[model samples]
Target: MKGLLFCVGLIMNCLFSTVSFAQTQNVSQQDALANTQKQLQINRYKYSTKAPKAIDGNSDFNSMDITSHGGDLAKLLGDNIYKVDSLVVRGTVDDVDFHTLWDASFNGKLSVINMENAEVKNGIIPEDAFWHSEQLNIEDGYITLIHLRRIILPNGIKRIEDAAFSYVVNLEDVNIPSELQYIGPSAFEQCENLKTDPLVFPEGFEKLDEAVFANCTNLTGKVVLPSTIKEIGEAAFWRAKISSINFPEGLEKIGDGAFYGCRLEEVHIPNSCKDLGIFAFKLNKELKEMHLPDGIERIPNNFADCCINLSHVNIPSSVKSIGKEAFQSCWCLNDVELPLGLESIDKDAFQSCYAFGQLVFPATLNFLGEECCTYLTGVKRIYSMASEPPACEVSTLNIGDTPFGGYDSPSTPNDIPVYVPVGAAEKYRKAWGWDYFTNFIETDDFPTAIHNININKPNAQNKVYDLNGSKVANPQKGQIYIINGKKRIFIN
Candidate 1:
């Protein structure tokens, strides 16, 4: 009887131990499931903004979309990538994928792609059913939105292949089906030659790589530059002819000469510009006016060159240096307010300007380089910014319509117009023996040139071609030859 009872107790203990173990495992599993459910709920709430719409499981669509954030959709994609991956991705038509071939169908803007592997369909992959010889590469990364004028991505796309639209010139129009996000560099380097009309990007384009439209010369018309754009490559719009441009506020670095010779009218220099390259607007004569903001440090050479009709400008107090020959030969330039912070006025910067007068130099100027106002006889009264010209000759010879009618004063033509400061007209007349031109104006207006003295022999060598080949004036250094633009060079 005692042996039987001991055996029963052992059995009961064993049964109880088995039940406890089972209960513990069940509770642990329930807790794990609850945590997982909580995580999934949080993830769903987090990605509520980016979730895709519901669709039938067996729907036949060209492509599928994946969420950027973590959620049920992301989890499902991660779980069944190999199964639904083929349908989401497009296989290259040919085994040897030519990037240009892909880009020629899209207008660059595609870069991320999950192309099919080297799996066989019949004799080849189903996506590789190419009647043409073109191919999509397996190892290559190519993302093309619409290659040239050949391809059109009507259905929404999923991912991009890198460098896919590289150098596809024929691309004319682009209406990226809201699914695209990437664009690579040199994608449309020279595409303006392909289409005669201007190209417009879809509203969704937010990114751009370097040198995208480096030399699209014929790409005319204004474009609202993407606000998201940060950096632009040098000479990106090297020789384009967009009539007017107001760089959309977000652009930071304007790559060296990006719009070097572009036909821009008026540009309001944004504070975003930290460095403006030299000769950036060299020959853009149509750029009539500009307003520079607070941040510019140096005004590089030819920055306002050939802006023939540019009449008014207000140099900001922020400017420290006007680079060498920065505003050379802008003939029609009329008014300029030089800044107080300016330390130097580079050589011949305001040279040959007919209307630029009444300059008030700041007190801080110590280094006014030689020939800063060359051929600018219009300026007789330079209000000294503390330092006067060391030995500047304010004599009659240098205070007239012609600063270069000879240093000894003109023996002929006593009718030359002499303009001087309020009390300085007599100073010039007495110094240079120009008592004949004593009828000068001090405050305003010069003696009108009603009588036109057309010089008979300008070149002297080409006297026969008087009204045809050259100017009729004598070859004087400061005498504007044929109103300047018409070059009267004596071919030596």
Candidate 2:
């Protein structure tokens, strides 16, 4: 009887121990689930006034939104501000709120911001509102804000201060309010993904600040600036992918590198434009033609440098000086007429222009910089209207550094002829850098018209007219023709 009683007690004790172990595990799992649910919870705050009330639930939240009148978002969200991924601010916000939002984007999960219904005080998005701090990762000397993807600006905002959205690489969309009056320097610069097709500015904006859209590679298509735009600041559209742009009639100035490295095919500067900056249109590979207005005095430096496909240009009669490297490496430039009032051609202005078969220098020209006309392998003849040769640079280190130096190779014969005024051949032979030429011919044609024309050989019955409007079937050599009301010469 004693052994039976001991076995029953042992069995009861073992059963009790198993039940206690199971109960402990179930409680532990329930506690773990509750903690996970708390961690995943998201809290939203809506304030009707300037002062915010204490958050009711757990303080930790993954995201938050302030729907109404929040005084300062940073203080309202408190310690949980950095954990937010999406932010929505409506009604009224201040510069401090924008700064806090920028900080969250820089350090935390804040990515999307919606402020379409909100209004910022003073009608401005303050300077450096979204400019990432210098502590983040930088590429090519620019701080790229990779977190923020989208933002909606308030409707009544009038101005966006300097560097407001500069280097926001991942930004995809933003609304430009109609009431906007000014966009400060470096605004929207380097925003590679922001695609504003046919970029149109509001009517009230008068100026495009410096580097406003610089390095925006995806911004393409035609751009029509508003008539109120008076000036385009320096490097405003540098390295953009724009195919064409139209300048307003009242535009006064175009800053340096404003359209450099673009894909412009043609440009027509208006008569009101008085100033053009250096490298304004340089490295434009697709540019084929350009027409300078009558009032521009100087062609800025590197104006059309490396434009290999450029074939024609119209230099106005009022131009006084051609800047350095203005037309360098333009290999296909075959037709150009230098106006009578052109005075100076700067250094390397026409270097490597291989398609110029003939050149006529104006009478007023007095200065020619080093290598101004170097490497012109296709030049057949040159006419100088000036009685005195233009002053050419003489290099001590390289003999082939003058205006017309290296025009003929050592292996190829130096057969190109230079035509001068009736008594100017001896003077050219004695002039600096002009003495290198072996052949000089004097002529009375102070302003001879040399036209490049391709004529199809006519059949025997075709009518051809001479210079005096006389008909001739077979025009002889050195005879000038007036075919189609235009002067033509046949050299057989």
Enumerate clash totals for all models, in the order shown.
Answer: 23, 0
Off by over 4 Å in 1: 1-185, 192-210, 377-381, 388-492
**Model 1: residue 116 alpha-carbon error in angstroms:** 20
lDDT score, candidate 1, position 311: 68
For model 2, the stretches where C-alpha displacement exceeds 4 angstroms are 1-66, 75-88, 134-144, 396-400, 407-414, 446-492
In terms of lDDT, which candidate is strongest? 2
Every model's TM-score: 0.49, 0.75
lDDT of 1 at 63: 32
Instruction: Give the clash total for candidate 1.
Output: 23
Residue-level lDDT tens digits of model 2 in 285-315? 9988887877787887778888888987878
lDDT for model 1, please.
Answer: 0.44
Which is the leading candidate under TM-score? 2
